[model samples]
Target chain A: MTAVSIDSAPKTAARRRERLASGRTYISAALIFIWCLIPFYWMIVTAFRDVGYTFDSTPFFTHVTWDNFNTVFSESLGNHFGRNLLNSLFVAGVTTVVALLFGVFAAYALSRLEFRFKFLVLGFVLGASMFPGVALVTPLFQLFTNIGWYGTYQALIIPNISFVLPLTVYTLTSFFREMPWELEESARIDGCTQGQAFRKVIMPLAAPAVFTTAILAFIASWNEFLIASQLSNDQTKTVTVAIAYFAGAQAHQEPYTAVMAAGTVVTIPLVILVLIFQRKIVAGLTAGAVK
Target chain B: MSTLAQPKRAPETPSPKTKKVQKEVGQDRAATSQGRWAFWLISPALVLLAVVIVYPVVNAIIMAFQKDQGLDPVTKVFVQGGPAGFDNFVHWLAQQCGSAACAPGTLGAQFWSAVGTTFFFTVVTVVLETVLGFWMAVIMARTFRGRSALRAAVLVPWAIPTAVTAKLWFFIFAFDGIANKLFGTAILWTGSEWPARWAIIISDVWKTTPFMALLILAGLQIIPAEVYEAAKVDGASAWQRFTQITLPLVKPALMVAVLFRVLDALRMYDLPAIMTQGSNGTTTLSILVVDQIRQGFNSAAALSTITFLIIFLVAFIFVRFLGANAVASATPKTTKGQEK
Candidate 1:
């Protein structure tokens, strides 16, 4: 029994040492995870805390309530948060759909066709997206005004589509290029016409890329504050813009908690999207630089 | 081979009644039709881009040369008059340099300060983000427990909207908020010059470092495990293996990511505008351009052109010197058909 105990003691010590090393790794990992997450946690805790308690020294949930969320949704100063939500939905939705529709066509050609100046076309689209968007605001603002589109939904939708189309095209083109030749050829051999082959064979294959591009484009348009701020009025303001301009229901109050609640509302959808489509988001994000 | 290419037969020659020739003809027809289909498929996007993006950009460039007429009596909006012959450019430069004693409210002082602020923010944020992001990427690339959850933690900040991020940090940097509480000092992060600048920079870093890490992680993933294994077997230390094998392979992706972040940082607006309202010495080029829109289109156009040229030049250098497209195309190749 003494020999067996002696043998196991050192083994246990070795095991303990290994555990300590791994525990150190876990500690560092936990630090990074906490560093990344604290702001989000604070955002939620402040979002749920009673309004007056937001400025407290301790950054903990003491007086938790749903009052801030209720205030964000309820009417205040003639700016309806619910209406802003719908406006954001409409703008982001229309922008995503239109960009996808146009982008798919361009992406398909860019990927599969051996056209003249193919590289030039790709380069041009990429360069357009990189053009400082704010630089265009001067001209776009002027043009929108001349056409009487200022404070209108089209004002936001048009520019958002223009800016986001290049991203969609780039991502989807990369995806489409990776599609194997055999898939399309087989569809052709099955007596399907080119259009039918596209509809039946290519469309299904393209769906995930399309979905990824859509989410990306949607988030971009949804998160857009510059153009929306410049173009939209109270009636047509997007959630991002509205939240930026959020004021207290009563005078002289900062409406800090309500703003946090609004921020949470806007952020929840994106967080859920990143969680659900984490792989696709990573793939789409690193599409240009990683491969 | 029979299906891909058609055999060309002279009309004068005797008809070759073979299966191969028939298939070749089918292939020829298919090839021509495919090209036509491609053209049709691409035209809509090209047309839309031409009208929406290309046209306005050209118009803006042209408008830069013109003079701004104050509000049109009939239209009540500013109007573009005849060409000003570099008047706007001269006026813009003059504002920045002509008189050292110019009023703080003058456009020139504001312009130069904004230039300085933008440069500072870009350099500091890009440097910090690259270093921090590279570190995070190294951690992410390591095989570990709960790696995915850690990746998600990093991504959470990135997934949230920039405006929300700005607001989140704005509260944190408030005089009576968490930053002060944690540090045991009241820094007035958004109400002072350097403190406000740091606030903007820190918030930007927090939001975008994940993006940098994600890109770098992609670069790291493409480096094969066998290379490191071989290096270790050869008695190379971890540091040596990393410097020799990993750094060289990841350089292209790193350069592309940095250039992308640089371009993005130059156009930064949402964060600073939200965090400090461009007060406290945080007005960037974007904020200046937007601010000048109310004054006149001509000056703003000239400013816009300058900004565009700067961005274009940076992109040109990246593409020409570093071969950004080469590295860009590399990422997709590694990921090919994996999504399927």
Candidate 2:
């Protein structure tokens, strides 16, 4: 008891010393917070500015307004913000569903199956992603053209899935591997079919990782710009291409309150999505990473 | 069904015939067990990947050959020998691809140089961000108040869409804009090449370092606290503890952070596309491809080929040589490599 007390004496003193040394942490944290907020603050300020305010230094304070939002939602864009929002939602939803469904299976295989050339398969997926998406536009353009798939949602969706597949596969695989081996062993000994056991137990348990990957795939697909531009000519433009170009040349010229409004419009949903999945994403990515 | 669901408790002293029958059934089930689990777990991702990745990649490789210009919607029919073979390669090399005859400075070697620029952008940004992020993660890990808020705030840049990020930088860095007003009388924020790219590089580093830091923080959590205590008790300095105690344990995490960032930086398109549009020397591989496709250049296919190669190389090398520990460590927590 006396020895334990002596140990505690030093530990308590050490903790006090450590706490004193950490005084700088609060200051650094505050600075980081301010730095992070500035960009978002700039974006919000620009979104509320009047037409010519953005060009001058006075834009920061000349009075914030709804004019940009008013223009974006009501008068400016050919397609209303609501409709573009729909387009973004639908695309994101589809991408999430497909990516998750496939991702789960690939993960299971990598986690469990001792299939031939499994490592090579992993490499192939990684390698495919390495293809600079922009440079492949030529081949994608040609491929889509020959098949008459150009300017279609399939054009965009198919390529998006392909690009994300390798990372998603690896991501989920790592997730599956992290799962307890004991559960699988117990299920096998209990005489449940392997498929039934996985369905009844494993899939349910992996839900968080699944949801995380789904959100990521959805966000990437939703925020995507280039593929949307090439795949859609006029009929099927996405929110990104819609807001960046077709909606306004004022991205450079004339009244950017509308453009700023459009920019704000374009960013909100994904931000919300990030918040929703932030913790899960952190869990999923870390699980996949920490082997 | 409920009876079937009951656990098959081992019979203590069963009749010989009943025992034989039970044992046969159990053996039969076990025989197919692994196979069933294997297929059940493996097929969904494998099939989807094959369809999405395997098919398109194979098809795209085939498409890179041939002058498929006849297939152009603007044109009525197919042109067979339409500069299909090495012509796209030659034209890309000669800088004749998007020269005024095509689209002026966006295609061919200009495009390849953009690929080179993309590599430059990715390497510089990844290196800087990784170092900064590691330091930040270390700082944040120390006990402090307002740390949660700071962590949340750091993510603010990442949460904002890239297009929005471009605008924020544009606001700060544009000629006659707040950047110049606040800092000096005259500066080229966008008109010149290096300054324009530097603006983007700075914004990217700001936007992404949080991601790296958060990831490293997650990795940092894995090291045993006892180890740090022991090191400290041994009179280790801050630098030694970081290098000796912290770094080796956190290396896998660091690699995962770096690999993810490198792959991401290589695929960078929207940032450059929105900001500089390959104007000046700010062009990256992605910008070049977009420009070529938009211009109807035959080399657009060739550009995609080269760009894909760069990203693929980075992904492969990072995953291959960097060790799986880094990838596995960072997977579910930091980068969203997780699947449901």
Candidate 3:
């Protein structure tokens, strides 16, 4: 009985040491996690806390309430805010699909086809990608105005296409170049039309890359504040612009919590998108700006 | 940030009918046709760029040379003006008795000062970010428990949407907000000029320092352990190894990181727009351009061109000094090399 107890006790001691080491890692991780979460935490807390409590200069603990969120959901501001979110989603969704079509086809051609002036075209597009987007905003506003497309989806859609296309094409082109050729050739030999082969074979292989491209394009379109602000006057304002306008038009910044609540609303899909495809996204992001 | 972007190594997809292309080439040595099927395929994108990017950019350049005759850009009608060559330049130079917003030396009152402030903000933020990013990267690159968590933790700030981030910072820096509470009394973080610039810079740094680290980490992952081991055996201090060894080896990625951050910083819009709304000395080139356009000035086109030139010059200096290689050789070629 003593022997068994001694053996079990030593095992427990070793387990205790292991537990201590793990505890250290957990505590360190928790600390880092808290630091990471502070902004998000404060955002949520401020979003929920009453306006009076938000400004309370007390050194410590404040009780929470969902008054702001409740107010947001039960008001005209909430209704407009919700509509704008939908507008951003719809605009972003359409923009992504269109950008993919342009970027992917261009990538396919650049990657596979032997064309004259190819290098010049490549250089021009790549150079254009680096051109400050802000510089183009003025000209675009003019162009959109000229086309009688002001305050419309056509205004945001076309420019969004241009902005996201270079990156999309650049990325997809590189991804397409890296793909093995045999799958394409074999399918070609098996009587698959180039389009069908692409649709069936190349596209499936490129699906992961496509997802990365689409997600980014969507996010860029959604977060686009400058263009959305300038071009969309009322009917077509995106959520970001709408929220900013909402903040600005306030008698005071009365909707501080509401603005953040709106941000939380806008952030949901993005956070989900980031979390779900974190690995693919990590590679895309790290490598994206490099090229 | 990964959600924001990823490298698309231009797909080098081999032609499916290379034999056909080769045969067609040899058969038609005196080719008269406009390129090939590939050109046709890429034309839609080519056309989009041609109109949206190429046409506007080329137009901006032409407009810069032409006199700004207070005309409608869309209608091309001179509502209140005539061609006055070098007058716009002189006006911008503040040589022709202009307002303080167009003043020569003092910042808060001149166009030249606005330009200076833009450069100043870009330099300070980029320099600070690089230093902080490198420090964070060095910590991350070391082998330790919870490294992945640490990496992800750093990435969270970067992943938050810019509008959300800007607004969050706005709240934090708001009068009677957390910033004021912490500093005691309501500090005007954004309402004024220099304070507003600082506030914008602070918010920008918080959001983007992680981006700088991620880029540098890509560089750090490529450094072979043997080099570090050798340095350690030679009893090199951390600073020596960092300066003499790490910096030199990772110079390429570092440059790319800096170049990207600089170009990005030059186009400061969102943070400043929200933080100060172009008030005070925080009026950047972008905000200035936006204002001119919003004012319905034909000169706005000319102004955008000038901004483009400034941005291009900055980009050129970065490219020239940084080796201009987009293909990051600092990325270790093998999977095993990813282990730090």
Evaluated with lDDT, which candidate comes out highest?
Answer: 1
For all candidates in order, state the fraction of native interface contacts they contain. Answer: 0.64, 0.49, 0.41
Q: Choose the strongest candidate by TM-score.
A: 1
Ten residues in sequence with the least summed lDDT for candidate 1 chain B: B1-10
- Summarize candidate 1's per-residue lDDT along A205-280 as a digit string, tens digits: 8899899989998998898888888888887899988888887677776687889999999899899989989989
What value does DockQ give for candidate 1? 0.48
Q: Candidate 3: which docking quality band?
A: acceptable
Per-model chain A TM: 0.89, 0.83, 0.79
Every candidate's DockQ is 0.48, 0.37, 0.31
Query: Candidate 3 on B37-110: residue-level lDDT in tens?
Result: 56677899889877777787776655555554455435766655556565555555553422224334422135
Model 2 misplacement above 4 A: A1-20, A55-62, A75-79, A113-116, A129-131, A180-191, A246-255, B1-37, B68-84, B93-106, B294-298, B315-340
Query: Candidate 1 or 2, higher DockQ?
Result: 1
Which parts of model 1 are misplaced by more than 4 Å?
A1-24, B1-34, B71-80, B96-102, B326-340
Pairs with backbone N, CA or C atoms under 3 Å apart (clashes), candidate 1? A290-B331, A291-B330, A291-B331, A291-B332, B6-B24, B95-B108
Model 2, A14-101: lDDT tens digits are 7798777676666666667777776676667777876656766663557678777777766444646666667667766777777777
- The digit string of per-residue lDDT tens for model 2 on B83-121 reads 366656556656553222335543554755776788899
Task: Arrange candidates by DockQ, descending.
Answer: 1, 2, 3
